[model samples]
Target: MDISMGDEPRRLTSCWLYWIAVPTGDQAGVMATLGLTQPTPVTFAEAETIIDEDGHGEAEGNPDGLSRVYVSPEVDGWTLVIGWWCDPCDGERDDEVLRRVTELSARYGRAQAYYYGAQGDGSAWLIAERGAVLRRYCATGEAEDDLFTLGEPLPLERARRNELGLSSSWGKAVGNDEGGSEWKSAAFHLAPKIAAALGISPLALTAETRVRGTGVLALTPQGAEAEPVT
Candidate 1:
């Protein structure tokens, strides 16, 4: 079935079968923009996945705990990265989510795995080329029988995301009608390990760290630099 954003036209839900994309810049900001809460790392493994880019802090690795399988696919000159929180089919919903990512992962050439993060749910987000989205799904939003929700502008700008090698917008549905899965709540739910490793919760740890976790994609050549993916 097709989900409509009023008169904006219909979008396929097939994108759901794929994965969600979170920007590396503003994780919490994007969650709030979408009415979702920030997510904290759940298991010890999760804590390890979170990396600090600024190098202001560091975290110890978690040898125990559940970590989902990971896969990085390349499609249509883009990298499609996917990870599962757990396996669902084996009743390990989290691993299953990761399995889906591996299954959905594309081979080299077009779309490749760029970046991936573990999701609270049994799923993770994959970052791929904009072109991959077009080819992966029919231009008409038909071929894969998929639909997407073109929601409001994320906290981050498209120009910024370009610098991050991600798209400007993450325009699929990741929330309930009431925006149930707020990243803020997610952040609180997580162990300090995950949050610390990913450099998340900077808003709390630092005395005056800005909460600028906007998950926008960088589209310009400049965006593709070590700059924001606006």
Candidate 2:
């Protein structure tokens, strides 16, 4: 049975994707260093096995430290690596883990990583690439926002000025539809647009980037257009 489909085994509180510039053959070495048990190439069967074995493990105490690692079929000379952590919470541990993964992966080549997850009362999404944090969105008390530069400053400025507006209202809107799946879908869908605005190839988005907001400017074939969630 497809575990990703069917009755959800548990509340999926966190998901992450890493675009590593390293070859797919290097995935095992990278993951092993991160303390992930069974750090095998991702496949339907492998995923099922991990889920069956580690599904009940808590994020804060999972012995494996990672649920799974997926190395996407090579595209445009880059290999996309994805990771999933369950029931994640905000803290130094999470930050350190993300930092280590990105930093280590960058040693091999350019790496872009992002994560999306909800805590007890709020949700957030973050993006990083080339060893610098590109964007961060959190729907906590005051809705913190952060963006950094990686050579392209104008686009970052534009995105910041535009401000995706992923405030509490936007979260409520997406949460009401499809049990929060819409938010994840929208966040992934906006990756390409965000990359374009950053003047980078969509693939440079590390196969996926998490974004949140009420409105976003998407680049259509016709041209750039304003897309508002509300």
Superposed Cα deviation of residue 96, candidate 2 (Å): 1.5
144-219 in candidate 2: lDDT tens per residue?
Answer: 2222112222243234334643332332222333334434344434433443343332234331322111111111
Task: Give the best candidate by lDDT.
Answer: 2
Instruction: Give the root-mean-square deviation of each candidate in angstroms.
Output: 21.7, 15.2
The 10-residue segment with the lowest total lDDT in model 2: 213-222
List the candidates' TM-scores in order. Answer: 0.19, 0.40
lDDT, candidate 1, 176-212, per-residue tens: 2243234223322232222223223211222122222
Instruction: Indicate the TM-score of model 1.
Output: 0.19
Off by over 4 Å in 2: 1-25, 32-37, 41-68, 71-76, 86-89, 117-136, 139-157, 160-230
- Model 2, residue 80: C-alpha shift (Å): 3.9
